[model samples]
Target: MSLTPLNNIGEFALLERLAKLINIYNKDKVIKGIGDDAAVIKPDIDLVQVVTTDMLVENIHFDLSWMPLKHLGYKSIVVNVSDVVAMNAIPAHVTVTLAISNRFTLEAIDELYEGIRLACENYKIDIIGGDMVSSNQGLIISITAMGYINKENLVYRNGAKPNDLICVTGDLGTAYAGLLILQREKKTFMANPYYQPDLQNYEYVIEKQIKPEPRIDIINKLRELNILPTAMIDISDGLSSELHHICRQSNTGCRIYEDHIPIDMMVSNIADEFYISPITMALHGGEDYELLFTIPLNQYDLIKNIDDISVIGHITDANEGMYLINNIGEAIELKAQGWDSFKKEE
Candidate 1:
């Protein structure tokens, strides 16, 4: 099959094709979308707006060797949506921007947009507007997500109080385990081009890494249950790093149980294969995108029956310091050793 180069159609034609792919879900909220100076949005009168932006660069954030453009597009939106949802808000709109080199074909760009459209449809979000630019290097994706929430429901990182319960949604460290499997397969393929990777057994972790869903449902569920989170953050960096952010901002300390840190069976198995500790991955492996939050201790009964939510620990006074209680009941100081964007690559 002959591939159509992006230069063949030019920028305007490309935009026209992309605009056709998008379907605005919140027609009442979006006054204007694509093909305008800027997107016009109708704001909620009583709710506060929540906005977040995230950029994914090729090689730095993803490896195209195994990462499909479609999945990359979906994930770019999800990472930003996760941020908005972390604030106890439902994401409503997003603007996607892309910088691409000459090497990428028009068809490749279409595949990426297809993934974006799917995510918007699933989340009931509108693609308001965005920019496409030429890049000297590989592909770069930047997405800004917007949402609104009632002032009473807005959760921040600095609202935790002593004795509040520390909770997290879904499992942790699975994405990092998926990354490890992908990296291993990539290495094996690089060393021997003829070697075909057998990845049937690693589906769970692989999917978690390639296509992680934001914990939007959890936010909605909490609202239905009338459970307000005192402090909240998405576990994009890692469990330990996000916990530190909450503790530092709230001027409180934390004590999490090692066993309570949820880890998937597949993640533990993969960690064993890699000769790494599963608990270490749960604490420091990034890209989980799950919600970490705190609620009053009195609300424990409301969450105890929830299967996906785990009460891993509790907040404490600042003077007590942050710690993790091991299985043997020994306390270890918590440290943030998760993803650092500016950290020099070894």
Candidate 2:
């Protein structure tokens, strides 16, 4: 068979070419998929629908050298699902679109989807529909996640009030620490081809980077405790960035205690090796995928003893401004320096 460029075949033909291989099914919920103007789905009547989309691009979002394709596939789905969960919703379906260069083979695509399929099974979600197209450069994956929540259980970023306790699920900075370690290893490997990557010592931080779990458990635990967050956002863009988002949306300020922020011992040890503060990583690092939320002061007693959660701060009047109080009682203005996609690297 002659090797044909994707441009020679055109969009419709390419779609037709890939359509035969797609086995996306959603039982009775997906009434329409491909060959239609839009996907049609039947949502549960008692649940309020929530939607979120995320994109990952090669080099920018991930490096193929360090990121396994299967893990990349799983991470993509998890990130979108994390957004849905952040809104206090349960993910039910996903639409996956891919843009790939000719460098990708059918086997490669299958490998990627294998991870997606695994995630779907794990999360109890369905792959309703999506699109596939050719790319000019490297690979790109975009996913749109749909979820549902009862109206009374819905959460938002603008519902925080003064005196609400600011809390975060799981430890922070582990992912960023993992990335730093990977980058350093990659550089060393590039310089010395015979050098073996020593990742076993950094297993926890490394796993935190490549296989970070979304805080679905936090949402479940909150429900089990009969508590609902007044305002909530996922820690995709670091704790400080998420805190700023909640404060800006809720029209409130916050004061977080540096000592109160949760950090894994492994992450702190790793940060020491990197010559950076673990607190700095927690404040500005991104992609931890934990849940950061605020609850009423009255609800504090309900969550005081929850494992893997920390009450790091409290909401204050907007005029008070966002500040971080160090252990010695020094207050520093909080800054949001999370990942900026558009900003050119210096």
lDDT of each: 0.92, 0.86
Best by lDDT: 1
| Lowest lDDT 10-residue stretch of candidate 1 | 337-346
Best by TM-score: 1
Deviation in Å, model 2, residue 33 alpha carbon = 5.2
lDDT of 1 by residue, 1-346 (tens): 7899888888778778778888888887888899889889888788889999998988889999999889988898899999999999989999998998989998899889988988988999888888888899899999999999998989999999999999999999999999999999999999999999988999988999999999998998898899999999999999999999999999999999998989999899988999999999999888999999999999999999987999999999999999999989999999998776654133
In model 2, where do residues sit more than 4 Å from their true spots?
1-28, 32-38, 343-346
**Collision count of model 1:** 0
Off-target runs (Cα >4 Å) in candidate 1 are 344-346
lDDT of 1 at 315: 100
Please write out the lDDT profile of model 2 over residues 1-346, one tens digit for every residue.
Answer: 4454555555576555444444544555667655676778887678789999999989988888888888888899999999999999988888889998977765566568777877877887777667888898899999999988899999999999999999998899989999999999999999999999999899988888998888888899999999999999999878998999999999999999999999999899988998999899999888899999999999989999999889999999999999999989999999888765654132
TM-score for all models, in order of appearance:
0.98, 0.91
